[model samples]
Target chain A: MEAAVEMKGISHWFGKVQVIHDVDLSVEKGEIFGLLGPSGSGKTTLVKMMTGLLRPSKGVVQLNGEKMPSLKQLRQFGFMAQSDALYSELTGRENLDFFASLYGMSRKDRHLRMNHVLDMVDLTAYASRPVNTYSGGMKRRLSLAASLIHEPELIILDEPTVGIDPVLRQSIWSELNRLRNHGVTIIVTTHVMDEAEKCGHLALLRDGRMMAEDIPSQLKSKLGVSSIEEVFLHYGGGARA
Target chain B: MNTAAVVKRILKQFHRDKRSVALMVAAPLLVLTLMWLVLDTETSAVKLAAVDVPAQVVESIETEGITVTVMDEAEAEEKLNEAEIGGVLQWEDGAPFVILEGSDPNTSGTIRSTLQKQLSEQNASMEWEYWNGSSELGLFDYVGPALIGFFVFFFVFIVGGVSFLRERTQGTLERLLASPVRRSEIVFGYLGGFGLFTVVQSIIIAAYSIYVLDVFMAGNFLYVLLVTILMALTALSLGTLVSTFAGNEFQMIQFIPLVIVPQVFFSGLFPTEGLAEWVQVVGNLMPLTYGAEALRDIMLRGSSFESFQVEVYILLGFTTLFTVLNIAALKKHRPL
Candidate 1:
């Protein structure tokens, strides 16, 4: 299988303070890769670098063997930032159409894509409502649908399901699995232990360092732990030791 | 103790953010000082041309501490027409016939009064003649063009800066940076979008100033539109450029005293004669200075397009420079 995303010796700094130390990671094509860490463990920073929103201080990020942040490569990925990033003044359909135009989609394609994504996120009924009137969960769902409107080959989601209810979260995860089955790569960053278990592979980060990277079950068995939480605490505590 | 805690927090924030503190306090003070200096400058003596005057009349006119240029009758008429001489005193039937350069009422009035006093003292019976087939206008007429330019610059700067700053504060700017769109495209898009509104705004403001307010208008209306549009573009670009430094809407408002106010002071709203050379240079650098000068030429003096070409070019240069700088400033958000 080909690697869909690659970061080699990636490190980032804000001013003089290092936020993401030298790190290497990759996501295989058609697989869901999860980066699990507590808040401030550099998950957002790392994801930002991969999405080309930020340039790493010392490393190269490539998508499909082409350098990332290349305008050409940016067209291949969808991004859902931690913040909703929706235009509050515009209606849900308008926001989707505006973003779709930016991707150079035809008018007909934009309409079809908007309907499809709106239905997929269960926001079809609220398509005409202004986003400022949306509840937090609905806004999150709209943001998710926006990321998928372009039907990018890779989707980078930063805490995509943070405020979602458990049932909705399950549906979102299942949707991710369905997209993966269609040969889409997904990179999700979350601190929730249960969410980590659903990824095909996981990178557990602590204090800006990777504590462990393996399949969820292998990471559990290697530490002789029954649950992913114990596996995290064991590796996290061992790093402190 | 609560008051003390609040005061301490305010002081700490000021110390941490020196740029905001400096702009808030220093910008206004600096502009105010410049205004004081410009307004307080001494008035220079008015220059007049004496045409075919008797020696006694010329001597009497020269006694009033005014500068007199002796010329032939035709030369004096030409000088008055060109606005080079404030007024011309020519002998008609052994009496004084006065022709005044009537564009600026203050200058024309000074010349008329000075000549009238000199002719009375000389015991010469004189009849005054009117030029341009009309009486002198009010001071408001002379300054109306500058006022129009100043208000457009003032309002557009505040509104554009605040809106852009709000976008930054609301996190929409970051979202824009995350897309595949180039930074230059965003800046150009803003220019294109806002340019549409400003066109209508300039037309309304210019029309109101000309037709409703009854301000002086001697040049073509289309020329006024050209100058107003250029002025609006300059303000728009500067507003967006400065928005990069402002963290919020309030901070954007703070720029009025720093950026917008100084332009008014130097925009020929007030006389800059006898001001310090450096003070005059500062006004020369401001975009509104050229705009106001060009507008006054078109509306008050009925100047032709050739007369305003330089100012038009300078205003366009200012807009282009500010737009490029604004695009560069966005690099702080996204390197590419």
Candidate 2:
């Protein structure tokens, strides 16, 4: 069976500065994969490449065994960028409706999926309110809702839970687990250590290079450390952290 | 297919932002009204002092609008110096020589032309004929077509460009690109949404100018709408293209002097006859020049579409070119 996501010898450069060094990655279906890194560790750039939002300077990116940057393949995944990309002038429901339609959802399907995603993000009550009136945490949840409205097999989220509170974060993680149990593949990028622990598999990246890739507990055990942060420190990733 | 979604969202946003809609629709009427008030004044009556001139000549000079006061040389000179009279008309040598108080161009030009018409008509040797517009056409009437084109271009450029810029700065554009939506779809979606709004805007502005303010409309109103709509689309596409380069709203404003104001000078507000060759070449490259020319041909001369088809095609070509540039500029965000 084809892996849910696959990349080989991926490298990217923004002008003279190389942001993503050579990297290889593969994630199996029905697994929650995490990319852990500091702010400038190229986590966003790497995830953007996987969605064909950016073309790598050199490499191949495939999702479900299909070469990316194809519109047909693009319909199979959803992306949420580091910034909350909701249209503040629109109601929360309208924002979701717009993205759902872009995925070629029917009107009836849009109504169903919009309500479902809004419920998943705990935004059903505030769905009719303009996003500009939403609080920062609310906006973050709404963005997450928009990304999931299409119900793609794979979802790529960049720092999805940045300003969200602990309770909502727990709920969101539970939702991710629920989706994973139903055979959905997930890729998430974050700098939060505890959040990284929730992923079934983690890749610790620093300075555009992957330092280690393993299950969270196994990574700590192999380094004889008690926490993922120590395992990160063990691999020279704590200079700024 | 997703273009409808984008269009629907834009219309909803416009509905929410009533102030911008008002700016686009009503502000032009206000400015055009003010321009009519200022430029459409009745020709102020010119008062002339006739000195040592024959009774028949003075009587001829005192025709319709011009009123000639019979006086001696000293009285006429004193009145002229006091600025109470516009000019001193006296016989010098064998010819009728007039001394004009040249402070105001309008009054002095009127005095000169009045005297010339009267003196030349003493022989009844000259006949006047108008080939196009009557002599009653005011400054407002002459420049009204261009101003309509200008306002449509200016407001649409600012509103459309800034709106597109907000999508970039607010990060929504990147999110939109992440979908299966094609780049051309996004461009077409914006064009359709804003294009519909501008159509209504242009009609309101054109109707108010022609019917209420009474600026001049000799040709078909439908053609005027057609030209104005094309002008608005040209501005819309150019605005989106410019937004691709603008970093923020402030940068978009900065383009007014660079991109818009020069078009005003070339847009038929001022005569380009004496301008340099290269300068006229630059004006030909601007979309407003063609729009203004097409508008004037239709509004002033009542020319048929065949006469201004070149301008029509050029405006369409400009829109197509800018729209293509807009779609290509999206590549900066998403390679596809």
DockQ winner among the candidates? 2
Question: Candidate 2 on B1-336: residue-level lDDT in tens?
Answer: 889889988999998888889989888888888888887433456777777778888777776578788889888777754446667777665457677654333455687677766677554333332224555666788789999999999999989999999999998898998899999999999999999999899999999999998876779999999999999999999999999999999999999999999999999777574579999999999999999999987887677889788999999999999999999999988899
**C-alpha lDDT of residue B120 in model 2:** 70
lDDT of 2 by residue, A18-96 (tens): 9888999999888999999888999988898888889999989998888878788889987888899888888999889
State each model's CA lDDT, in order: 0.79, 0.86
Model 1, range B148-170, lDDT digits (tens) per residue? 77767766676667656766786
Residue-level lDDT tens digits of model 1 in A175-194? 89999999899999998999
Top candidate by lDDT: 2
Model 1, retained fraction of real contacts? 0.28
- Per-model TM-score versus the true fold: 0.84, 0.86
Off by over 4 Å in 2: A237-241, B40-125
**Model 2 chain B weakest 10-residue run by lDDT:** B123-132
